[model samples]
Target: MSVSSRPDGRRNHPLSRPVDVLERRVRIGIVTVAVLGVPLAGAAAGGAAYEHDRAVAEAQRDQWRRTAAVVVSEVTPGMSRGDLAGDGKAGTAQVRWTAPDGRPATGVAPVPPDADPGDRTHIWVDRQGRVATAPLNDTGVWAGSLAVGVLGAATAAVAGVAAVAGVHCLCEHRRDRAWEREWDAVEPEWSRRPHQGG
Candidate 1:
């Protein structure tokens, strides 16, 4: 008889389908592990980096508090205020000052004893004269920026992992279905076929 006319058709058996299902499960598991692992590792690393950055910033701010003083030269209308770093070469303090008229001014003055830059930084004056430096208020902005950056990165990483997992699940489901079909085609022939005449 022709192969098609045989009692056993090409239809697979359900029992044999498990192999394909198992293979798909293994593949999906592997992909899921990889997808989830990478982001978790990145998040851990980001946390560490954030901590390191915070520590460093705190240390720097503390040092600035000890060595520098805040002095408000004068306030001006429409004047933009900002923070100014020490010139590094001069003992003179550099600060951004705003005039009552709202005008911007840069002031440089000799460091004063008993002056703390961390407190009331709006006011900066030296025995020589008052100087203007940028406003110290921007520290909060900088800190916020750092936090936002870390959080954003972490969110992106988690989203990416989720997407990968979703794709893996979809592919596994399709594979499982295909495997079932394959097995269904093979199963019926088994019982009718001559199995060593047993």
Candidate 2:
């Protein structure tokens, strides 16, 4: 409701209270960390995640092979689960294909529901020509890395905010105590009462 240009002279500086200055400095420090730390934390986390995912993808690529398979018979899911999985072609089908080692392979894979005999469908297989899940892809690695990066940034921001709040509360407590002590000493003098020993 009111403003004072002249600060109380009891403080170290005529311009401000010590607690106010300390609180301001703490707030600024926390804000700076939140701003600068988020990106740093995000990058560090993202880099680690990227390395881990890329390593996994490399391992999968080395271990799995994608080859074309000819649909020999259908093994449709009763509830349309297989066709709904959406790898372009779906519905389980008995298929024949060649492995990376040039060995003739026969396995069950997903194919179109209307797939007829001899329809070519791609499948992933191991060295033994057994049906296997598709190898991990670069897209998955990027997605995972990005998610980790976001989580890291969020963590940094929350830490920064918590730090600021803790310091603010501590500074407010100190300010209140200082004000109370100062008022106790000054209140009697202003009221023209003799100071009493506490």
Candidate 3:
């Protein structure tokens, strides 16, 4: 297309349609954020969260210890069902173990359903001798971090696409309204008939 002078004597480039220009600007913003900004931001945020979780896990590991405990009560099937049936079953049993302070401690802990009294099992306990879960390992931390990062990136991308689509719809609506107005103004002159009573 070639550039030509407008009716007001100003030059109008063939590519200078108002709707197209606005749409291009909107697309640029969306692409910049969705394609460029989102992933970087997600990585940073995920890294920070991962670091925090790792530090906590490290601290927990330092503050806790594993010990052998002897079951003092018969283990029975746990109440949980469905896909989470751990070991295909679970049980609560009273157990006895040597605490960090060298004294015997007793607590209720989860055990395999087949565990009998006097059966020995490994258990984690805090410094205060309370039963606790094991600390997250390095692999777990990395997996968690990756999941967060992916979720963040996906959410940002979706938001950006939705925003661009919304802008496009608005632009189309405005363009259509402008066309209707122009047509209303021109239709009378364009459709005028020759006078027959002259």
Candidate 4:
């Protein structure tokens, strides 16, 4: 393509417009960068996200703990319809338990959906001894990192394609305007008749 951009081909070849070579080169450069840069950016994003999330997860796990508690009320007394579909997963309830210091303690906790009064269930507690949701697990950290990476790569890919297309459109406009200017300069004389000394 570069070889055909010389004056010989620019003036004689129907397809070798001067603007075409620049457009092709720009397109190739854009594609090359996209191919190499997007994945690199994604990997960098994913790695950074993973490291950040992993640190957060470690800190959260260090400050939370799982313990045994007993349900003191019906799981459905404070819940609406279908909140406990009997899948046996955790459901909100008031519970009784002994704190790490052996003093009796009670708070709202998550227990088995099918739990009744006196049923034991495991629950998590925060550093200050309040019932809390479990901390971030490894799976959640990995999933978040993967999502960030994928979204970053996808957005960059779209931007790259748009840039190449934009360059191509600009080149096409330049070539067409050049042809139009040449035609404008020659149209009058070409339209004149031979007897009119055109």
Per-structure clash totals for the candidates: 39, 0, 0, 0
Best candidate, lDDT-wise?
Answer: 3
Query: If ranked by lDDT, best first, what sequence of candidates would result?
Result: 3, 2, 4, 1
Q: What's the TM-score of each model vs. the native?
A: 0.32, 0.63, 0.72, 0.72
Model 2, position 4: C-alpha lDDT score: 47
Q: Model 4 misses residue 51 by how many Å? A: 0.4
Model 1: worst 10 consecutive residues (lDDT sum): 74-83
Model 2: per-residue Cα lDDT over 69-93, one tens digit each: 8988855743233322244455677
Worst 10-residue lDDT window for candidate 4 reads 79-88
RMSD of each: 14.3, 6.2, 6.8, 6.4
What is the model-wide C-alpha lDDT for candidate 1?
0.49
What lDDT tens digits, residue by residue, belong to model 3 across residues 1-198?
778886878676785668867797789988987888798868976898799889988897899887899999977567322212134456778899998889999988767677899999877788899887667777767877898888888888888989999999999898888888877777767889543331
Tens-digit lDDT track for model 4 on 65-126?
88888889878544422222223355678889878777778988766667899988877777
Q: Which has the better lDDT: candidate 1, or candidate 3?
A: 3
Backbone clash total for model 2 is 0
lDDT of 3: 0.78
